[model samples]
Target: MKKKITVILKKNLVNLGSVGSIVKVSSGYAFNYLIPYNFAQLATVGRVRHYNMFLSIKQKKLNEIQSKLQIISQKLNKITKISVKKKIGNNNQIFGSVSDKEIILNLFDITGEKLDKKHLYFPDIKKIGIYNLDITLASDIKLNIKLQILPAFI
Candidate 1:
């Protein structure tokens, strides 16, 4: 029976393993491909301990980020509606469409949380009364906000 060598992955490899993961592979494959390319390292006791420590630190940081996102989500949920003013045309249609930038700025004004416009999911508002906006806070957290468009007299 051939003995498999234990290795710790240094980076994520598709179909292989993730970073900091301990896996066993054939010694030839480990030495030729994984180790030579800096993809993995020999999993000695000390290296394993260090990897475990690194994983713990990473998990701690992830938890902190998640908690902060949760707080932001709570604040965003408190906002029930956002009002936007645009010039009305002859047929009650907005002259300019509402875009993600406008929504992001309004959210920052109301909630005091600065969010990337990429996180907002909405269709272009040409003629708007009440529209639903989906804001992705995290993979697991989403916020729904109502958008109200009022006619501006200029």
Candidate 2:
């Protein structure tokens, strides 16, 4: 049975090319994954038309936000100072850990930008001095921030 579907594109669907394109997909796929993963919705005639117009507005808003982020990223990229305090012994191992959440929080306080924790990459940062963080703002937008972690005196 053919059903009207409204798919709210999320994370820039490979096929959709944007974040609000509502296209018709099979009912089974819609119910099984798209809805659950928050990739789409039921595009009734009314909803479809509404979403189409909304898409333009969303694009405009996103463009504006992206432009602002670009300027911020440029400033952040030049930053080369970050200090993370920790308690450690002679072994140079940190008694506590520096989490991505803390990093994001610190960055937010500094840049006025809410950085997503997932976008903060840390393969290994046990004993840190200075590290480079690669953050993804959007599909095409990205930023690099410096993280300086220092050991807190006991």
Candidate 3:
């Protein structure tokens, strides 16, 4: 017979803590993944007895990280203005339309944030103008950005 257990999560678990919250899970999985790896601990009577201490430490750490993330989010929330330079023909059409990979690289060059090309919302940008884009930063954070497209200087 296998026994189940609850644990105080010290970090992000599949469906657990925002850093430090308690949740219930299977004993074997908890022992194998949570305990050994130190991501969580058994919510035994003794551990629960000292839950306050655990919570205090975890909350302090989470508070600090939240502060830093808030700052980063502020910067991210500010609309990012990016200008793309492309080669164009007679009809203002790019010989080769700009790609998300190119835009991602340019974003990295400007902001130092490593964003995947898939995150850019635009399917294909073939003309010059201001466009809005959405970037998924992990499961919890998403960002919006703008790009200013222009023809490349010959």
Candidate 4:
């Protein structure tokens, strides 16, 4: 019978496994190549415990971020309308078309929260008028807020 030993991977390897994963391989491979190259380490009790603790801490951080986003989502949902001011050119036309970056900045100013542009689904905003704004916070969280574009002398 070929002797096999269990080891924890230090880095992801093609055709093997990801980092921190415990895998059993032939003794020769583990001792000769994997151990010598620093690709893996013996899966001791202390190392496994440390990895589990690290995973728990990482999970906690992710949960905190999700909760913070939930609070921001609630605040945004309460918003009924948001207005954007823009420079106007001749014939009362907007000097330049509104962009996603500008909208994100306006949202931050109003809510004091940073938003990613990928969450926005914009409407035609060439002229100044009221338009429906679509923002997707997550797969299940969506918000529709009224947006008004007004002309500014500046």
Best by TM-score: 1
Comparing 1 and 3 on TM-score, the stronger one: 1
Clashing pairs in 3: 86-152
TM values, all candidates: 0.88, 0.58, 0.51, 0.74
| Model 4 misplaced regions, further than 4 Å | 90-92, 99-102, 116-126, 130-146
Local distance difference test values of all predictions, in order? 0.90, 0.72, 0.75, 0.87
Tell me each candidate's RMSD, in Å, in order. 2.1, 7.5, 7.1, 3.2
Q: Which wins on TM-score, candidate 1 or candidate 4?
A: 1
In order of lDDT, best first, we have 1, 4, 3, 2
lDDT of 3 by residue, 48-95 (tens): 768877778889998786676566566667646778888887767777
The model with the greatest lDDT is: 1
Question: Which regions in candidate 2 have their CA more than 4 angstroms from the true location?
Answer: 1-52
Q: Candidate 4: give the clashing pairs.
A: none
TM-score of 2: 0.58
Worst 10 residues of 3 by lDDT: 70-79
TM-score rank, highest first?
A: 1, 4, 2, 3
Candidate 3, position 67, lDDT: 75
Q: Candidate 1 — worst ten consecutive residues by lDDT sum?
A: 1-10
lDDT-best of 2 and 3: 3
Candidate 2 C-alpha lDDT tens digits along 25-128: 76788799888887776666787688778878989998899898788677667666656777776667776678888787777677777866776776577774
> What is the per-residue lDDT of model 4 for residues 1-154, given as tens digits with 9 covering 90 to 100?
5599889999999978999888999989999999999999988899889989998999999889788879989889878988888887777678778888988888888899899999999876787888888999888778998888998864
